[model samples]
Target: MSYLDPAIAVIDPVAAAGPYGREGTAIGFRVICVLTQEYRTPYVTQTFDPADFSEVYQHSCIDETVAFLKSRSVVAVVPGAPPSLKIVDVLAESLGLIGNPTESLEARRNKRVMKEYWTRHEVPCAAFHESGDLESVISWADGRGYPVVLKPNASVGGVHVFVCANRQEVVDAFNVIVSRADPYHQQFSTVLAEEYLDGDEYFMDLAHTGGGEAMPVAFAKYEKIQRNGNASIYKNMFSLPLDDPIALAALPYVRSVNDALGVRYGINDTEFKMTSRGPRVVEVNNRLPGASVPLMIQRCSGLNVFQENIRIFVDGRRTSGDYHFERHYNICCLINDQPGVVQGYAGLDEVRELLSYDGERMIAPQGVHWPVTRDLDGCWGLIRLVHEDREQLSRDAEAVHAMMRLLVA
Candidate 1:
């Protein structure tokens, strides 16, 4: 093995004050997170902007990141379409980075382009519309009619995402989204309108790295606890198996997407909903698996995906086979999303008392703000219970949650 010292930086606009940001820097990679906004951390913060210098963010932030590393710089970058590719472009221009090219970023970010790409690859996916104008968007929505999904081209963490059921709802949502986008852009307030998917939705960890091949790492299914048509929280995340043929749904698209997007390194999380016909592609992200789930994968597999992720960024190694261990069961139980003050919690102590492994935590403070919204708070408290027996693993999750109750003041 070649001894190496790879300097890495993970640039995230949303995760500055996030737990992932806090924990990520400590693990391994020499991470320098450029914040679009301030984030909570004891680590030194470097401030930067995507709005500066006609794509200066592209060269300075992303391209310059690799340059500054002065080594094999691997940025744990987040991927998106054209508007969101500020970081992706930097990686694309860099010296030993893995990511999609600007052209592929366009095809992947815009839902319509994504559908076309999938179709070209013979990959099964729901039909979608990529329109930028209010008229075209409304027409597309009217055609899909009731129970359709509408989202913006450049956004993350499920920001302002809605599941509309009628023309009124979609039109209203389009109007609302229009207000959020930059009106001066070439296309003003354009959005993707797609057919609503029924049945279970699975998040696949799909990405292609060195040697130019796709690798499927982790899978997670969410039980969305919604209130009044709003997703208040994501509860009971179940880790899935990659070996299953059906679970490999996104693997087929990896090659096409990578070849199209020119993705070199980092992670790609693709979400596809299972329908009566089959699995249809939803969207693909060109970055690491978001915060909570990656931690959940670590808890169950004892693989420390976060740690392994850091290693890849700093070392250019793909597989975590070096530190292999027997995999076990793992689950992340989110605290209920209801507004209240920090009073007290129940069963937390009991679960802690029964802990057999570590990756477990309760991030919420006793008197801090309780989650009134889904995106604001990640997990009120997480129950990462790992066990060998699937039955015992299931029971442990139940018992741990049974042990937890928040006394919202």
Candidate 2:
């Protein structure tokens, strides 16, 4: 598309280079990238190219940026990452474009505010408290009993999230979260503590084309193994059929969550725990699912979230029909259990030889010193598996974990 064509403003296009950058071009719209150093990541700094964008503007001042975006023929404003969630709302409201309500920005981005909104709307959510004082957090957790969860009020990729089994653990977890800045480089003044729900965690991807309704697009159950006191170290995530029993049960609750958060436009990625009580929400993100999840969904189900989102915003198309899987898909996270300098990856050839092996993203290259894989961000890389047979896909996914080893010295 020509630069003169109508454009979409994508703020902090971190992991969305493929989606809003390249795929947006394929769908016939110029992409205007509003860059930010505040949300820097390896994906943004090392992988993204400025050439992919039609016009790049540094977001040092919001007024200047909004003024510039207003000068262009921008039709819609969308967030490319979590840090840009609030900013996207601001821009969209300022530009008079289709987007989420700026009035409920906190309900979409802050964990504490989100839960409060859900509770007010009578949506089932975990019990929680937010405070900067350790005594206040510990007191709340004590009343709730042992094994509470502690995390930043507005952080992504499971940064500093810990499942504390006792008061000591809570203290330790609290110190860690408050001691460092979040992935977005913002210091945490308050930590959110919530009662830990005991059950399997599942990821549900939804889209709100327009109106008050949000459609369910895809669902995946996360296989998380607790290690080193962290409760949500992702092992693998496999796609579930639309008609799956769990998917059926969780659909209504997730849709309610979408509505509660005021996510009337763009994609929503919500994580829910299938607790003994029922399906309870873990967290809600008003952006595309991270870790190339949309790509995997497209590969297996032929539903390109990126393309569909552009179609909805740019072409004014409403989504219809249900999503179905054409192939079994699994995303296996490559982990380094111990921290050290990387030597090389072992048994990768064997992993590639598997019938279900589709592709891999090796984030930690050889000779790079890396920390132990405690959360999604610390993972060595990710290996994607796809096959016609679900059994073969499962076997290959397990084999990937066993065969592929991150050799850290």
Candidate 3:
């Protein structure tokens, strides 16, 4: 499924540009880097820098973007983040490129809208209410019961999400959620409060064709670092065996949620809570799975989520062949709770010896004062580990946690 010269327009690949270029190389497509900043990366074949009019969705900027696309016949447009997705949707629709509708992107990016859509379509989800009024949210939570999850209407990486067990906590958490919204997107201020479903959490990464079909690449079970049994400050995700019964059982619900969202042409990261009633949708994001998931999935299984999305859009199909699911149980740990300046890392040589990792990945740059993590985005660093046996995995996780110290000032 290698393309000879299929030019793909990618919008704002994050981390100063690496993923998009790697994706292009993986699929043999020439990536046209369309960015918001004057960032440079070695992976892209060509680059285009337009005016900052799109920060306000300016008409002139859109015209320039269209003009640039016309200069090269792009086979598809791939957006990295939610904001970038909105921009690409507008540009793709204008240029007749493959992408989601603007309205769908808008709705999907907002939690309130996505929940309403799921509710209308009879999708299995938690009871939720939204308002700028904290009193109303408190009332709704009171009726629902002890715990409720408050989150910003529009966000990424679990930003401004709080689990409140009481009315006062709800008020404090709601204010935090509201204040965390992006200033430009006013609708984001409308916070959402949902009846928190306490259960085991899991996530699935997959690619969809927008044709009512989804191909699951990898599945994971999460272990949350909870504070006072309410707020999840950190997340430890372990890649479940692909053929595990729990993983198999969640596929139908995943497909239903994907179809309900009208997902067509992109990678999706869907997180859910497996309650006593059944699996309930926590959130469905139309984007690539973050952190070390893409690499972990490739290590555990032959299927590459990023490349699969490209193949889905360009070739109108997924990677052909059975996945060689390695028996390795991979764990991705996000150290969010530890806060301070990173003086140095202890047991670097020992941890590196015990764990399998790419040499380039580290906790974070040292000496910068680190703040207390309030959400998933504020996580300090990612530590990836893998093992073949469950007992060995548990033993390795403990050893790594104890030895891989983030020495803070």
> Which candidate number maximizes lDDT?
2
Candidate 2 lDDT over 1-409, as tens digits, reads 7776778888877764345788778877888888776455553354467788898888877788888988887888877877788688888777777878888999999999999999999998999999999999999999999889999988777778999999999999999999987656767988999988988999998877777556778888899888767876888998888778998899899999878888888877999999999999999988889887888888988888877887676545655666778887899988787788899888889988999889988888678788888887788888999887988888999899998888888
Those runs of model 1 whose alpha carbons end farther than 4 Å from true positions after fitting are 1-6, 13-29, 39-85, 91-99, 108-113, 119-122, 130-136, 175-188, 248-250, 253-260, 310-316, 319-325, 333-337, 353-359, 371-379, 399-403
Candidate ranking (lDDT, best to worst): 2, 3, 1
- Go through the candidates in order and give each one's C-alpha lDDT: 0.54, 0.83, 0.67
Taking all chains together, the TM-score of candidate 1 against the true structure is: 0.73
lDDT of 1 at 401: 64
For model 2, the run of ten residues with the poorest summed lDDT: 38-47
Query: What lDDT score goes with residue 223 in model 2?
Result: 92
Record all residue pairs in model 3 with backbone atoms less than 3 Å apart, i.e. clashing: 210-264
RMSD of each: 6.4, 1.6, 5.0
Stretches off by above 4 angstroms in model 2 are: 16-18, 38-40, 43-46
Query: Candidate 1's C-alpha lDDT?
Result: 0.54
lDDT of 1 by residue, 1-409 (tens): 1114233444543322223333444553334444332334211112123332112222345545556544444445433222334554456345545444655666655556767777786766676777667778778777767677766665454544567776677777677666663211323367777677777766777534555466667776655554433332456656666665666654565445445545555556776667787666667766555535665566655655544554554444665432222444455555565678768777766777664434555556677767554431345666665555656666777776666777787
Q: How many steric clashes between backbone atoms does each model show?
A: 15, 0, 1
Model 3, range 35-84, lDDT digits (tens) per residue? 64333321121222332112211223778978777776777777654556
Candidate 3 RMSD to the correct structure: 5.0
- Give the CA lDDT, 0 to 100, for residue 123 in model 2: 98
Clashing pairs in 2: none
Sort every candidate by TM-score, greatest first: 2, 3, 1
